[model samples]
Target chain A: MIHLLKQQWWKYTAVIILLYVLIGGMLVPLGPSALSLYPVSIPSDTSVNFTITGYHTHFEDAKDLQVWFKPTTGTQFYKADSIVPIINSTVRIVFHMPKSNLANKHSENYDLVVNDSIDGTLTTVYAMTVAAGTGESSPAVTPANQPEVNQLKFKAFAFPFQKILFQTIRNTFFHVPMWFAMMFLLIFSLVYSILYLRTGKIEYDILASQAVATALLFGVLGLATGMMWATYTWGQPWPNDPKLNGAAIGVIIYLAYIVLRGSLSDEIQKAKISAVYNVFAIVIFTLFIFVIPRLKTVDSLHPGNGGNPAFGKYDMDNHLRMFFYPAVIGWALLGFWIMSVRVRIKLLQHKKSLL
Target chain B: MRKLLCFIIVIFTVLYTSAQSAEPIPSLMESNLKIYVVVGVLTIIFSGIIIFLLSMDRRLKKLEEGH
Candidate 1:
């Protein structure tokens, strides 16, 4: 087995690395999360005031602040140039929805674009539907009582899914896979930890340590992707949402695992203590990430509970599944592959030291 | 060996069955490319590690037996 491994190591490693670069790096970011339209209802025929709110970020201080609005269905665009200087990182521009526009038989679609001219940042693009007949002065009953409104009623629905997808490309690429990879690694670590505790084998301890290290790498990546995803999807880098909170807690527990490993000096003692802690981390991670969030009543941006369906149903269509499953398997297998290599390297280093 | 072969067979069967399902095949261009890249990178890295480990394991075992 050793001879075979030694002779063919380079070939196997090269093949694995090449396959990953080809599939994971290049193939997954090609989906449509670019443009979306949301419909908001207004009292029929009444001219409603529309307000466009821009979040204050570092670029908000830029000099050229331009807000543009155009009816998605109509040629006319209402422009408010050089609006009030953004204060406290937020600028709200109000415009009157023309009553005449609402008087038509169908609901009108309005697209709002906020641009920071100084930084050349196109802050946000959103479409709102002004429900027909909701405007002041209800029009006389026509063929259809009112036209369809394309504006989003709920603020959640107003989110620019497409733009978020583009901006947080690495979020999907790095964050989610990290979590999946982390889970697989952690589980492997936990199993080895258990075996070490039962059989008192130094080899199992080594496996446990390597698994924890691999899992931690995944955890960090998951956190980075999640933070970016939160920024684009929720319009903030971090929100106090339940799901976000849960993920934070879970990561902290894993960090504690690393700390525990570092605190002990004796190799045998370190292994045993760390093994115990790893088991605890697994339990806590499962509870915090999986159980607690599901039980909590607080609203979450994550899908499955709290009025949001997970990306699994809407985002994970047939095409996505094809690459997504492969991505998961490929990543998990790769994680194991790395862990094994690290173990071997450590074992060799130990032997060399003895020599 | 039998267990390894069985595992491979099971995986192949699962893949085959999943492929036969009614869902339409998704276009590569239409899917999220970002996810694909991340997964791909992770796979390569992990696979490389596994190969290296296997090699080391063999060498270590031989050294131990010689002793």
Candidate 2:
């Protein structure tokens, strides 16, 4: 065991460090409630009373609360002078919406930000849409001069800080990287498979098999992180979205590749047949992940479908792109490192077998 | 060998078909299904690769020993 550890120490060490970065370092800093959005909806031209509830787990102590509201498309947030001090574990703030502001056609929605001083928790500014009322009459009080149409810059909070440290956004880092790594490894596996078929060499077969094995590892990690992200974002452990279904089908095809490899007894024949099948599997997997998800008929809650924007103006930003792109490269490199080690091990064993 | 291959195919096909047929999911159910399938597929693929690698190692050992 020590000999084995020493021989593969670098690979093992790199994997351990990566795991630590994934779970202990990155995930812990990213809080559990990091990606949550509060829902708020109020009717226009009416006064409504609403309470803000904050659940406390770590610090049960009460804290000073400040609520901020700004127009969704504007910069200036109306800060409430009244600070609600929490008596019990839960803090509730009641606020009334002005009827006149609701009547103005200038604003359609408001962004709400709730802050706790003691715990230092800043809730994502929840956006509330204004519903039309029966009385469509203009506001009773009209300002003498309305600002120029273009100059009426309603400054709102600068776009929320680009990214959070939690596992909630782990999909962008972990899951996406896994898919990229898998794709990279699969490309090599396909090449090796084709070479094995052409040359009838066991070496190419071993390389192809090792590459698949490495790709599978990345695929699994991607899936696990995706599940975690979905649970927090979509409020469920699993969703039958088209993008998700395509992912499942893609994995199944690769798994079928493995099962095919296992069933063959003759080494030479197994290598030949599995190689052909793997090539087909890669094609099918690509179609499932890319082509199937793009079809407009398929209803999916994933971004980039069903009227949802792709990772365009909404999904990702510069900050996320910074860490995310590096993550892809790092993960792919790690996958290649593992594949090389496995291929070496296979070659050693094959040499011993021939002896 | 052929029989084992056929059996594995049969099991995988059954699973794939079952997953496909279980659809028309409600909004909440749809979200949950997406998570489950994505994670499930990935888990299967990863574990399957590890198992295949270990089996290959064993086969190499057997061949080495002239078994």
Candidate 3:
């Protein structure tokens, strides 16, 4: 395994796979999504016209269209009376309000679900609120005449379209891989540090330092890309997010490890001190980046944090996984390649200094 | 190295001019399409990689000169 690490073929593999990831991630279209619904509230027992906007939906091409208003609590669904296709991505739907209270509550939120032969089922949650009126306080009536939805038409290969994350979703291939690369590089540094401590070898020390330096570069790239992604999605470049802050602290701690090595003059002393510091640094860095952000008490705007469902659960469909896994491996291999080159340079410098 | 620098500078100039042409400055970044934002991010990452590679090249040059 160690011998293969010094080989040249993996670097070419990294380049080829990264090129694939870049092309595939960018070129793939997004699946249809119901973006939003207008007039979010309505009183019971009245027919209301609602405008539902969709993203990448083929309303014009859809042969059979069905719409439904399902309450948040019950299995009962109120079928739309009529639907008019406004445009390729917009539709005007009319739903008759239920005569009785749906959940026996004062008001109940309904999810706007639009389905068609070409676009499958698209839903916008909490889209419309139906307030109770002077009517019989009975169980919500399930419309018996609900039309059976046609066979869903899924595009051959596409990323799942999500609200607020449209084309910028392509950044996942470029931005997310940076952090994975950084993590792997740091792990390499940590392992080399342990090897140096055990063997008392200056070459292992050089490997450790070069890995950290490469990791720092990837860490900075990760931060820059993450900030760019956060700006458009979260409406701010820097929000008070736990994961963001943790990442920043982890980088700073690693920076201090570099500073600690620079302050020491003796080669053996520098290696010994920095290797010990590297161990502590990696531990604290892991705690900051991985542990603190995931604590139940802390809330983070990042996915999979603060009780929100992660991209793995829904957003990372089969199409995304096809590209995402390769991206992680390619970026990480590139990082290792860079670190190996640096180690070679350091070894040459050491030999020249001895001569 | 000089050729690489010139190439990067030209790319930046093209991006800047295209971004500033005919539309309000913020709308290009703020548009619902958001494809430009992706382009911006890709540019930043590619630039970072280029810079890192260039620095490595510089270090190798220095070592060769010493030899």
Best by TM-score: 3
Residue lDDT tens for model 2, B1-67: 4576677779988976776677643332236223343344345445555555566566566656766
lDDT, candidate 3, A31-126, per-residue tens: 888888888888887778888888888887886777898876655567888889988788898876765645457888888878887888887878
lDDT of 3 at A253: 91
lDDT of 2 by residue, A134-184 (tens): 565444433223221222111221112223222244346556778899999
Q: Candidate 2, fnat value?
A: 0.02
Residue A230's lDDT in candidate 1: 58
| lDDT value, residue A37 of candidate 2 | 26
Instruction: Please give the interface root mean square deviation for model 2, in Å.
Output: 6.7
**Model 1, range A163-280, lDDT digits (tens) per residue?**
4354234334345666788899899889989999998988788888877776766666566556645544566768877767777788788788778878888888998999998888
> Given the true complex, what DockQ would model 3 score?
0.66
Candidate achieving the largest lDDT = 3
Q: What is the lDDT of residue A22 in candidate 1?
A: 46
**Model 1: per-residue Cα lDDT over B1-67, one tens digit each:** 4475578679968965775574532332124523333343344445444444556566667666764
Model 1 chain A is weakest, by summed lDDT over 10 consecutive residues, at: A152-161
The candidate 2 chain B region of ten consecutive residues with least summed lDDT is B25-34
Per-candidate TM-score against the hidden true structure: 0.54, 0.59, 0.85
- Who wins the DockQ comparison? 3
Q: Which stretches of candidate 3 lie over 4 Å from their true place?
A: A1-6, A36-53, A71-75, A84-110, A126-155, A309-311, B1-21, B24-26
